[model samples]
Target: MDVPLPLVPAKILTAPTTITQFPDYPKTLILEQCKTIKDLNQIHAHLIKTRLIHNPRVAENLLESAAILIPNLPMDYPISIFEKLEEPNSACYNLMIRAFTLKQSPNEAILLFNEMCGRSVRPDEFTFPCILKACSRLHALMEGEQIHALIMKYGLGSKGFGSNGFVLNALIGMYASCGEVEVARHLFDGMSERSVGTWNSIFSGYIRSGCWEEVVGFFREMLEMEVGFDEVTLVCVLTACGRLNEIELGEWIHEYVVAKGLKGNPTLVTSLVGMYAKCGRVDTARRLFDEMPRRDVVAWTTMISGYSQANRHREALELFHEMQKTNIVPNEVTMVSILSSCAVLGALETGKWVHSYVMKKRMKLTVTLGTSLMDLYLKCGSVGNAIEVFRKMPSKNVFSWTVLIQGLANNGQGKRAIQFFNSMVEKKITPNNVTFTGVLCACSHAGLVDEGRGFFVSMTREFGIEPEIEQYGCMVDILGRAGLIEEAYQFINNMPIQPNAVIWRTLLASCRVHKKVEIAEESLKNVVKLEPMHSGDYILLSDIYASVGRLEDALRLRNQMKERVIKETPGCSVIEMNGIIHEFFSEDNIHPDLVEVYNATENMMEKIKLAGYVPNTTGARLDAEEDDKESSMSHHSEKLAIAFGLIRTSPGTTIRITKNLRVCMDCHNATKIISNVFNREIVVRDRNRFHHFKDGSCSCNDYW
Candidate 1:
């Protein structure tokens, strides 16, 4: 059965009349009715055949229809027609220039403007604004200044033009976009009369230059002067508010939007959401996001990113899931934020899903998105994936290289990390302070004290990069970890800058490892002076006392902690299974599967002990019985999380866990034996670094 074509209406089916058919009919009216290039071409053919192509008014109208009116019409069609013209007036030149700017060909617009000048066409009010806009788009400051002089020469300045706000607004925008924000501001301040557009121009100018404080101050000035603002003006000020985290002013803007009935604009609402989110008020952002009658991709992304920035990763992931149910597709920025949340939560499956989506969408692996994905893989203990992401990147920046190096260092691939640093230097990429920090950390983790020292000095001498506190801390770790405790103490004393508590704490941790109680006491005293009420310092000092068999001293230190009501931060471990994250704290008793998990933990402990896993109770309380000390050591957060994973997950599946604090010696030892006994691989990410356990050994070789 053949399908019949749908019948057409008589008006659309009728053959269109050409200019030759009705010589008296207005050709411009026919030009105005053109809905496609074919319709225009028919009229154009008639104009040429009837010798009406030479008529300036008729030809200019044709150009207007082709360049501006008709949808999807190529600009080259009008350009070719204009070139064939014997002479075109200001209107023809202005049409082409404006069309060029709208089509994102600013250089062509400037070239046409120069040709207009060569022909001595006096630029009208419309002429300058179009050309200035072109200059602004190109960031051509020199050409913009030449045009500004022309504006002044032709009496188009504020003093001369009287009320031509468009000209002044373009001037402001051009100067600002050209990076001459001060000049833009000077023009704005000199205006005897100002409009909302004038304020928006200056506001956008300041924003472009990162002068956010200036924007907020001027917005307040606008309010004081009782000026009216439109959606653009409000959005500009709200952006400044978001960047500066000015919540009070942001709230005020929200109120004004409501009172003035401007809440109907989605852009203003999204700005309010962004402002509140940046100010650490995700609840308000979420409320505003929910109240939106319709949500766009930008709005959804802003809200999701807000949760991520607040360190509320679970909420971020939840909102992302909600966004997935909507028709709006997540953009590159949204994926980056989701990946960051995944990294912090150790959600490897979720991160992998996002990666596949990016590939499915055929989106470019931009530097930022690639770096974010690499960070996620590294933090999730997917070292192979991280390396592949780094390798496949189209281009690399210093930060990209730094992330790879730091991630490798954190994953216990320290020697390879240093080789990458060397490769980076050989490629002429100068190491910044962060790069040096990663390099030094790599050396510190690999116990390369001499190499760490060399990099520290070379950072200042060879690269001219000054050592920041992070590098200083890494150097302390390097010295202390290598049993050079005396030199580490002397290094702290001889430092130019004041040592922070972290540096002292690093020294103190090494004291616990080497049982240097006398130096540990000195480090503890300095740490106390810096951070009074720090529980870790007291705990470290007490452990040092117990390690040296000074049981009475250890008891007294514990008593001092009790008298001060100081509480240690409990260990926490996070594991992800079936795309859901589970958290376990020390001696946790609240999980729904607590009974099963406890039974599994007890049975595993028995098996590990039979496999020669002896518990190291050095940090346990000296006042407790030996059995009680060993019992306390058995229930660390990572162990419980591991037990839960082993019981719930299928056999042969790798268990990846992230802990809040560094893994204790006893748990580290037990995890190795567990991996061997169960014939499964286990990856543990503690506060310090990663421990990949398999077949009765760890990647760190028990040094960490």
Candidate 2:
């Protein structure tokens, strides 16, 4: 029966249906179901065959699918489809613009918005947030302000559409991202109402601008207003706390997080760990790290970095090795921390391993990482490798240049450091305070007093950099080392700021060197007044007394020190050989090769003595006979480390040693003789500077 009826109108039965004949299911619902571009294309063909392409609803659905549903589709597909629309509304424009913004083609979003405006489609609340976000992504303050102006022109800020939280938050974020924090703050202040997101936006902006104090203030205000805080708020505030070293406040925030059951959050925990570590609470940070249920790369890196910053290099390396055992891969940040530890420990072999790993992983030598590597090699007593790393770096910032300059100066290559500094200036790289510090140090080490003075003046007059306390210390060191004790005293007296303990200590050290008893007494007075608990100050003053044959006075001072319960920081030296680090303390005999090391030391001392080396007992604090003093100097920590290194390493291999204190005159003389006798290059990095001994001479030229 049906076939018979259809035979009367075969053409009508087979023809395409009208738009109204389609299913009642929403086009948007159908679009949502279209998971892929292929599905969307089928829908597009159906829309065309049903004569529904003219239906704005169907067209809008098709555009949304093309713009948002499929991954990595060409923008041209959406744009062409949108262009074909007869009268695309603001909603359609917003969809297209949002898609472009999401795809990181922010300029295209802006163009689409302009086209929508030209077509006379009035933008609504939804339109502005998308555009503002686009501006944020592009960091285009000018474009963001224009969109803001459009919003203002439409009176959107007063009520209904313009006062939307999303739009306002997006506007604030855009301004902040463009480094226009003040403008963002003005808007934030005028907001009649705000969500937690608004507060977070302001906090993040302050953090990005390095206005950590303002971040703390905003957090306090947020707390006072009883606004709810999330993990983002805690992370930002914790970071501010760490920067300011506000440990007490950070602890309270930590307590708050724990109370809110947010401590389990990996991000908050990592921030907490970093905060504690930066605030000088590394032990607490480690405790939190251990308690974490699971650690991400950031957490592990933060913990490792915390230890490194605290100068706990052994722990840092241990933690780094532990991190390797896990599945989490190390990023540039982790490698930097590891390199820093190796630099401090002078673990050249370990540092080489890290360098090799960096190459193996194909990690790009970013400015920070490259600079860290250079610092590591230089600090580990391999100036050649450091220079190589520096030259191969693709880019150099003020910090990178400063690290190389400082490294050269520290490694007794002062003239070369100055040359590098001048080259940096010729390249128009503006030097920072640290840069000036390094250059001044170079001038001091190289005996360039006049150049040092000129640069010191030029720092303020030419570069507008006001010298800090460290710069003044370097200048005093320069004059003091050159035997201009009176000039140093005058300079300290005329300083614009009050001299700190370090300044007095530097002067006192110079007094000891120049045998200026009167100046030594005055410097010790100021040093004790500033740093009453500093054992080195008392020790140095006692040594000066002993040097002047005032043995009774020296004895009385030692007794006073014992009564005051102040303990000296024991001198320790470390040497790395065959990928192992050997540590030696003053008078230490704990190494497994102790007998061989001492035998080598005795033999080396005999040869040095035969070569006209005389043991200078000026550094021996004990009120003992000259023979006892000579024996004490022979067994010093650095000498033991050197003897151990000589016994372990191959012939002619460079011997590198790191000491916690300055090398005494006796050890310095003996090292020069040993370098000549053994035909080896000896690099000794002490508390202040480096000494390169070779062929009966030192690189410092006896100035240090």
Candidate 3:
């Protein structure tokens, strides 16, 4: 059975009045009674109409009546009533200040406090707490201290009610928020009285300051002292748990939350799901989400982002569609997660839908959304749309700048990519290692080895960011592309961090490019061991075997790959067809355009041959028969696609092709020949590198 949420009871304190004699009731006694707002307002209206509140005692009654009736209302109405008096007493002014402070306009409270001076009415104990409240909310430590000095001057410091729970709590909050934690603690410990709010403020301060151990220890101390947990405490602790990657503590908190029936609170549930997800337990996050009684937009967003961070991109997209099944609207956070999913999966259609949705719904998508949109288009192989999104953004942060730089770099616009990076530095928006990674990648693709080295050194010296393993991979790729094999290898060895699989693969690919078969074999072992789950290492090793004239060993490696227990990543390619795009890969040939593509390819092969394109079989086995080597190079999928693009498009039309693997040297040569013969430009973005073929030359310069 579903239950209802907690309800807050309305409360108002009425004015002191004479007890009336009714059926032997006490005469002239103090009247203390609760009255509704209408009852109180009627009395106030009568007093204002009659001008009877000119009496100090009558004015005090009206002030208390308004405080009781109007606390729920905005302070503006109450302040107007208080301001109307030719002059109100100390109590009247204090209530007005307190009301304004609680209404979130504390500056007005302070300004009013200044106006109270030189008035005949003296500020009593109530005025100090009220003014201190304004100071606390404003985070005006200097003003709070001044108020503190006044409290001592007025001799209200030691009075228990003057230095009451609310006033002391505000002082603690003010000190903690201003980073004076020790002072805050000293005051807290010395206080004879503390409320639940007092304890919560201190615990929250510890969490915000990243004092994780203190957070844990204080939570325990509170429990030991018999202070119970609240939603705010759980939220703060769970946030700290996520940052600390404390999955065990996170689970304990989740269990506690579930037992206490706190799971219905969306904020707590969101925090728990996010905590589990951030701790690398997306499955646990989903489990928690499933058990929850209700879900808000934040809960759904947390689950979506959890899948994203875990790289379960398909699941993320699935969640996005599922969220639409419910009435809850997707916010900017929801769009951010979906955009990340699109970026990972290269889902251009889904990304386009989100872009249209943003426009139609008039959702105020932020700069992060714009940046992710640019990235999604680029990853989906739509550089035109990526550039369009980039131009539309009003402002660009480092991520925004990096996306465009990376997009241009990925599209083989290296000179423009470098120029963009230079522009980023000039604008004083500091670039992170990820930005430099893109620039370094561009240099590697463009064979800007000198520039790569210069940037590599400057990234450390100028920015103080120590290079990570990926940066080392870029340096090796830069030198490797230039055929400076030994220098690339030496640079990897000199790296402070251990080289990962990508670093070794860069060296091996360079060896394949330069036909240095012996070195390729040595590098292949490291790459294979580094990522044993992936079969590209084995495939690459076999290619080196084929290049070195060891056809038997190449076959042996292929057989070993088949026999290995681990599954290989299937080969894949996306093709644009009709008004939509289709993906076909790995022994699958069901594309509608397949027959047309193949026939066109057959015709263009002849034209390419007539143009004097000699397939470079140096990447094949050295001892293999010439016929076998030539046959393998002839029907490569990338070459087939390039030929199809050439014959299917117009004479001068630019051919844009995307492949799932690095376009081989033989295919690169064939593409260059076709580009020159057909008098067209061909842009092929393949796995591992990009190639811009034009006038019998490639942007990779035949190095990749």
Candidate 3 stretches greater than 4 Å from native: 1-194, 202-226, 243-245, 279-284, 287-294, 460-466, 496-501, 521-534, 552-567, 573-585, 588-703
- Candidate 3 per-residue lDDT, tens place, 1-704, comes to 88998886687667756323321221111123425455456555655666665766666655665554443755555666787788787888887787677777889888888788756566776887678767766778888777666655665537644466766666676666666678778888987777788887776656645677767777778878998768888888887788788888888988898798777788998899999999998898899889877898999999999999888877888888889999999988889888887766556668889999998998765688899899887776577888888888888899899888888787777788899899889999999999999999888777788999999999989998888888888999889889999888788778888888889988987886676776787787777778776777776767777776777888887777778865555545544333233454533466566777667666776788888977788665444689887765665666555655555556786656656777666777888888888788876667865577889898666656
Task: Please report the TM-score between candidate 3 and the true structure.
Answer: 0.67
lDDT of each: 0.89, 0.88, 0.75
Work out candidate 1's RMSD over C-alphas: 4.9
TM-score of each: 0.85, 0.82, 0.67
Candidate 2: misplaced stretches above 4 Å?
1-147, 153-161, 176-182, 245-264, 545-553, 589-596, 610-612
Candidate 1 residues 227-345, lDDT tens each?
98788888888888988988889998899889988877888899999889989889999999999998999999999999999999999999999999989999999999999999998
For residues 11-70, write the lDDT of model 2, one tens digit per residue: 455443333444755575556676776666767777777778888887888898899878
Clashes of each: 0, 1, 7
**Model 1 off-target regions past 4 Å?**
1-164, 174-180, 621-623
Worst 10 residues of 3 by lDDT: 22-31
